[model samples]
Target: MSVPKPIEFRGSALDDLRAFPLAARREAGHQIDRVQHGQEPDDWKPMATVGQGVKEIRIRDAAGAFRVIYVAKFADAVYVLHCFKKKTEKTSKADLDLAAKRYRDLVKELAQ
Candidate 1:
């Protein structure tokens, strides 16, 4: 197999991920590792609202539901745009907007 691509956390994603409960954080890491290796996460869904090719990794644990929004279409690395604990069934507009902003920032940064 080819070498795995590294993950680049955008905005406050890393810090946000660190805030997840231990179990949830570990699961998130495992799922992201799968994405790095060009494999699908255990659970995921397209996040077209964030951008083209963007997706969200879903992780549920005894504590709560968590999400990691990312884009892996680029060759160099998988970009993690957002990480958050989901308090309700629906993803909040603020969370969606934050991820989209981060995605746009990443694209702009890479273009420079």
Candidate 2:
């Protein structure tokens, strides 16, 4: 079997994911693991506005809702662009902007 791709957290994504409640954190980890193994997360949607190949993984727990924005199209690794708690039905502009910035930065860095 092929090895799973490594995960590379961009910006403060890892720390933000860690800030999730225990259950939510674990669930996020599991969903990310699916991405690493070349499978889709249990709950996710395309984040085309963020960038090509970007996707958002959704997690809901007793604490509230959470999200993990990542891009796994590159062969080397899965790039997690951002992580945060969802505060409303609509995703905050701050979150989208951050993820887009990270995605752009990742692309620029990889091109070097």
Worst 10 residues of 2 by lDDT: 1-10
Each prediction's total of clashing residue pairs, residues at least 3 apart in sequence or on different chains, is: 0, 0
What does candidate 2's lDDT look like per residue over 17-66, in tens digits?
A: 99999999999999999999999999999999999999999999989999
**lDDT of candidate 1 over 44-103, digit per residue (tens):** 999999999999999999998999999999989999999999989999999999999998
Model 2 vs truth, CA RMSD: 0.6
Misplaced by over 4 Å in model 1 are none
CA-lDDT, candidates in order: 0.96, 0.96
lDDT of 2 at 50: 100
Q: How well does model 1 score by local distance difference test?
A: 0.96
